[model samples]
Target chain A: MLGAFFTGSAIVERQRLGLAARATLLLLCSGLSLVDSLHQANGSLDVLGRLSVLVAIAILAVVAGAAWPQSVWVPVAEAASVAVLVMANAGPHQPLLPYLLAPALEAGLIAGVRGAVATAGAAAAMFLAASPFEIRKGQSLTYSSTASEWVLLALATGLLAAWARRLGVRTAGSNEAYPAAYRLMTQLRTVSRHLSGGLDALSLAHIVLQQLRDRTGFDRAAVFVPGPEGELVVLAGEGNVPDWDTSLASDGLMAEVWSQQRGAARQSGFSGTKGLVSMALPLTIGARTVGVVALERRFKWEMEDDIDSLTSILDEAALRIETALLFSEIRTIATAEERRRLAREIHDGIAQELAFLGYVLDDLAARSEQEDMQGELRDLRAQVTRVVGDLRLSIFELRSEVQGQTGLGAALSDYVRSIGAASAMTVHLVLDETPNRLPVEAEAELLRIAQESVTNARKHSGAQNLWVTCRINPPAARLTIEDDGTGLGTGRDDSYGIQIMRERADRLGATLSISTRPEGGTKVDVALQARPVEIASDQGAGRDQ
Target chain B: MTTVILVDDHELIRQGLRRAFERDADFEVVGEAGTATEALRLIGELQPGVAIVDIRLPDANGLDLVKRLRAGSEKMGIVVLTMYSGDEHLFGALEAGASAFVSKDAPAEDIVAAARHAAVSPRAFTASDLAEAMKRRLEPTGPRLSPREREVLAMLAQGLGVAAIAKQLFISESTTKTHISKIYEKLGATNRAQALMSALRLGLIRQDPSPDRP
Candidate 1:
């Protein structure tokens, strides 16, 4: 009985059961067994026999009560030992059969109906053998009655075993389901937290994919979401699936799953190996298939059974993706509108005031006879132009959206020209690249990196000449920004800009290096590999607007 | 004197502009209007030689007013003065029949010169600023050529044929032709000279330093 409790405690820990109830059951079983074992001793022992019996019981009690049992076999072994001890020590006339019931009942509860019935059968056989020993010791046996009693005992044990088995199955099923549910709940919580925290769509998608990969424990997982072209493009993936084509055409199993807007098992030929079964789960929100998650290593039957679990997680992820996209849209619109308002205000207010100042200076210049006064007025007018240029650039940047249709190269070129016009430095821009736009997220990051580097140079470096070069070579590209400034490390106390650039480069899977030129100045070099191929016939046809 | 109607919302700007014009013997401030309706009425009543309109009037866009004024009379000069410096604004103004487009930050002399030029030859008047922006907006590349394409066009303008450009750019001749074709496509040109001319006019390619560039 005590061993049953020990085994139960182990199972409870593994299954995340309540600790307090299991501990109480263990204590109650141990106390009842000790009292019962002593009562059945029937004064058959002299002091030495009594001492031996007490010692034996004490040892059994300690093993059953204190020993930690991890497996079902541990408790089974203990039950067998208890039955043997009971048969060997209990006197023939005493109520000896009751002692045998403990082990049998425990086996029933811990292991199932078959285990219980088998244990009872063995106990009954041992008891019958003891009856023969009793007959040899001149104790007459009522054979007919004893045979009926044995039948009754076996019948009772079988019924108890069946009852225990039903209860055990239920507990086991719940034990399996609880943790999966909890993990999914936690994942949902994280998604909401990230959304409220205003993480951008790319970062949010990346984090969610990582979490899904970890939680599902798949050998390989990749998230393929529809790009602006309604073509499935690999957004993020784990394991040995990186080198595969990033875009998916509308005729494969992946596209079929997307069109079907449901999950099913399909076979894929990955990396030349044929017939590898994979589960393609579409992430749909309100009848629209937003994306598909392809998972290798999940068997067909297993996925069919676990589809509910997978869908619950994928559903939440889809909602999050939708929310993130909406959040970014709202942010973009709000920012653009706000900037336009500010620009209009500045144009009406400060710009007009400065223009009036310029005219005033012009009037003073025409009237003044002093050459020095006219020169000062001219210098002041130049200052006003610089201020106006600065304002215009600000307005342009605030209105600039990386996801805008004009493409990143144009935006960067405009920016560089504005800088040249505003500052004393001679800025040269060389952008030779394909017209195909980078993914919106990548464009945004590249723009940020360029802006940071240019601002850093303009503010601190005192550079006379700045050269910004962007070259696109189909699936790869390079951006090199060099300045004839006081070399790389001269006066850059702010490491934040460099850190941000590194982070952006890392996110884009691009290599970035900043170093001092051997001849003069500083150079920033960034090399980007891989541009997602367009699979859809028409670009940007997916957006309803 | 070229009689000019100054239609700006800011009183200080109108006063300063009036003074700048009063100083110039070739120009006169015939009227001033703060709103589009007022400007239309003043133009109709005073019949100024030129009307300078600010784009962001409280009541109406200067482009719409320009169109309305142009529909009324082809002879009256319409000059747009605004803070917007993008090619889009310049194009919008030009499409609405404004003869000149100038940034608000331009020197007083530039505005006076634009007014004088517009008053005399309203049909032929295209301020250098407006003409440059218009050319950029009309480029086949649509004012957004990548720097490398610009470099390629500049080299082509200097009379480097495809093979010479390829060698200079460290690329193959086939690649050079591809770049040249793309440049031509962007410039809306059927041949090399047309692409070069458009690129030069758009300020996309550097003008050849030769005396014959114009």
Candidate 2:
């Protein structure tokens, strides 16, 4: 009807003008039909009238399609297509029909189950109103048949509505939770493992953000966390944060989601905002809330379903970040302990000797007379020997390869042989358990014990015979030293050197055992459990460092 | 002439002292032994007037050799030289029948002089020297406890598990436990070895009869 005015003004004037007017008329009619279908009326629509309605609907559809390129209508315009089909199926031939698929499809596409059901009811009523019971044309619409048709139509409609609604909900649910769902799949695929490996907070946070990005899509994603003042500041970001009065907007939209505590969004008329969108999650590691996360993305979509995925993703990511931070802190503490141990070793092994050397040199300088000078020279020579010993200990302490370079086996052998030559007693050493190398701490402890025992035997024990042995296994290593000597100053006075050895053994978590040799001698034993190669070596490196 | 056997692990110290001793007409080296075993064997063979021995020898320590010589040849006077002169060593050497426990730093002449004197009688060994040596051994040098204190300490040093010691003393376990606790307190010791070490240093324990269980 509206096309009559446009045609009078533009038909035959130009193809473009005529086409434009027709397009506008079709669009207007299609929209009008949709409104009619949606609104319920209880009055009389006769059979002829219903048939005309179908004709009009078909015309409206044709025109609407033609008008498509010229009109930037919303997706909601799809309802017009459903309405056109509904009328064509139930046209006034009064085919005595009671149901149609168009309404259900339209409902599934647009309003879903309830609306589709309602549309079916309306269509059924329209069918009854269009053609009343007339027996002459043999179209005798009995009350029972009419009631049955309405009943079947209602049931079919309700069922179709329900089915379409289920599909829509399932698809929507999967789509909205796609991020979390994907994240869950990934976590299942590659759950992390325990390690002594370490990392820093920033690096862990970086990993968290990276993982989260994989699970979701966002335009200008950013993480805002609480600052010192309790106001949220950007701790990390994925996208730009637009300055907007997003405070209450987020609170009102996202914080109110009931089931999951996830925020639901509407076409927010949140004024004074610049394309701002946000969702906040209470980040939890275990039961403690170290911080809260505020995420915002600038995009338009139904984001309500994403709530579940986002919350879970953020929560897991937060936990991992915390764990990584702890690992990093532990590494720092271990490094510090290593430094302290190194400091003590340096002081004890090298520094004290140098100081003693300094005193010896001073004494030498102060001496007078030929005989005194000769005696001083002897003292100087001993100090020099001590200085050399200190240097060896220092070098061994400083570098791992130094011991190997000097050849620990060779050094130990040479020490025993040399000491034997210097003293009356014979020193014998045996090394068994071949192939596998002992850990560095194991080696160091063994060396210290050997040195102390030798010194004590030479200085206190009038022992004539000495024997030392080393045994190694995968789990543990052992060293034993024995001497045929009077035991520890009549077996009563404490050996300070032995005490030091015991202290060191305790530090290594090794076992130390000593006993009087059955044949009037002394025997000292130290044993340590073997650890995994990597762990043992790494521990050695840690202590060495 | 005072005939003697020279026993030592260090040949230089032994030879050095020998040159000074042989110069005296009264002292003569009848035999030489490098270890406690050799010294004990030679003591059987030589029957010398005196035995000059280094306290710290290769084959055995000071007290062991002294005890061996005393047991086998009770009449032979013995003189011992050592780097260590703790009360435990002094009393231990004395208990082993060492006529005297001398220091390594002592002049060779002084050692020869002591050896020659020991051959005669205990009167030849200065009581003042013996007393001074014992005093040094019985007193604190560094952080070590006096000898007698170390003995009393050994009772405590046996450990918190000193149930037998407690039973022997007819004391309650708790009281026994308290004594052990006080021992730890005085020595700043946390365990058995520490207490034992403090007690040994203090010379509060008997160090003469036997050696420490290694």
Candidate 3:
């Protein structure tokens, strides 16, 4: 009865599971005890003993039945109820010595080996206490035989208890870990599906950030890519924190993780951060650290679980980013190759035929010495010249793909000189070539920007002289095209030239400024503050060989 | 008479070039081939004094054909005739040892003159228009000379003597002479007149708009 009271209190406090096993043991013991007392009442049993036994059984049943499962006191209550039933039925007719094993058996079933051993010891002590009364009736041999059976029962039940405990431990471990493993598998499938869809680099970064947020629910998440001269800059970020410093300093937390190429965590008060605990993970591709991922949130003990899984998820995400980058680069090369093919076709087909037509006309005009025929031939030749000019311009546009034999500076110099020959305007090109050229994509973008500016100046600005300048200073580069002609008027930015230039500049992470010069001209300038440094991978470079 | 073999993929273009050469009594059309292989065989068999080759042959690039023909015989005049007037093709033909270059769209007189020049001189004989294009290409769109060197070249074009230029620039005569020599080296000229002509062609110095004194 006392064990049942303690078990009920523990269940209410802890709210553990497994309530049914403990409740059944208490109920069976209490009901059997009640019947024993009732049967003994008609005999020479005193009224006070029978009433006390009945009361204890009722209380124990009520308490144990109301208890929750998996409590420390559950087996205690079950053992106590068994002791009461055995004691109440202690007589030769019912042979309560056989009932002495009940407490240990119930304890073994309910709480395993330890509870079974303790309950059996208590049952044995009670059997001894009631043995003298039974001995006076000359039942000592029956008592000794039943006491030996009780010890055997305890041993058998102890083995069953140990077997059950092992099964429970395995079940508990699977219950906790299986669902988490399944979730990680599902997340990996979603990432691979997105990768196969051929997402661009920026879109890929956004999707990875969204997935990280959904999986870990960190307060803030950001990806930092390596910039020129070992600098790290935020490529993408998501969270309550708005407008984070785009570039992380060399001494910052993310930089430390990036440099070491490992994961690290910080608890509050590191460089103005407060309340939130932050962890930085290095985003590695092959053996090199390409970037870093930083996440932060308000401190919590449960965040340790979040940290463990977030590292792996971000590692997978880094691989996706590299794949997306490579896909974009391949697409660029394919487009350039297609453009070169188109240019060659135009050069070899229509342009060649037209030049032959001019020769035939020249030969016919020379055969006829008539003055009127000479004038007609002159008119025809002028028309042919105009057509050839337009075709050459088309060829130039198509051949804008930067060939590997020349850098952007030499290509631009060649193009401007060709234009200068045909145009009344004198185009000047000034280039300060860097020791190492900008990346291929970046160089292509700058070339387009310069091309658009020059074409716009030729067609719309009516510029007599255009100056094109390109200068590179390590992590920064600037390109300027200024024409000495009519200034830019209001609402001129809506033109396709300006819109395309702005879009290309955005791709390069450059600032493009178009303004009318005070001396009467339009000047288009593009400045890139931080450029992506090309990592020199020996294996990648060796693939060509 | 200069013996000429016409090589063009288009039959009509070859007929037109043959007719253009017939008008001149000093020139004779010996043979014609429409493909690079046939042209090479005819050039080897007929051994014409000059060959007018179109840049876009049916089988190979005219520049490559020029390179091959020049390798076989240095005396045969190889005049590159092409529709494309770009400097890439022009310089490519000249660099490949062609004796002359003439665009297909140019006047028949220009080709005749190029052929005559090729047969007689056998030196690089760029057509007048092509020569002008080559000069324009040589004109540095970027600053090829230092500011001081440009100033010296401009003074030299203005008929200033070396001592007079030194006095005007407040520099020693030796420094002025050094600037002049650098300017000559960059302009690829040997004398004052050639240097002035190059400077004028490049727009580094404006042409004097007034009439010249005799």
Candidate No. with top TM-score: 1
Instruction: Give stretches of model 3 more than 4 Å off.
Output: A1-199, A202-282, A285-317, A367-373, A403-405, A433-437, A459-462, A473-476, A485-521, A527-545, B10-19, B56-58, B83-88, B127-214
RMSD (Cα, Å) for all candidates, in order, is: 16.7, 29.0, 19.4
Q: Candidate 2 local accuracy as lDDT?
A: 0.51
Tens digits of lDDT, candidate 3, A222-250? 66665433344445555422223223442
TM-score of each: 0.56, 0.25, 0.50
Choose 2 or 3, whichever is better by TM-score.
3
Ranked by TM-score from best down, the candidates are 1, 3, 2
Model 1: share of real contacts kept: 0.46
State how far residue B134 of model 1 sits from its true place (Å): 6.6
Q: Residue B69's C-alpha lDDT in candidate 3?
A: 92
Candidate 2 residue-wise lDDT, A299-396, digit = tens: 44334667667677767766665554444445445644675577546544454344334334433443445777767666775565445444433333
For model 1, the superposed segments whose C-alpha errors exceed 4 Å read A1-197, A211-222, A228-234, A237-249, A264-280, A294-313, A413-442, A455-466, A469-480, A485-519, A522-545, B129-214
Clashes of each: 4, 32, 3
Worst 10 contiguous positions by lDDT, candidate 1 chain A: A536-545
- DockQ for every model comes to 0.20, 0.01, 0.10
- In the range B102-186, model 1's lDDT, one tens digit per residue, is 7777788888888877787776647555544444445435555656566677677677777777667665454455566667877
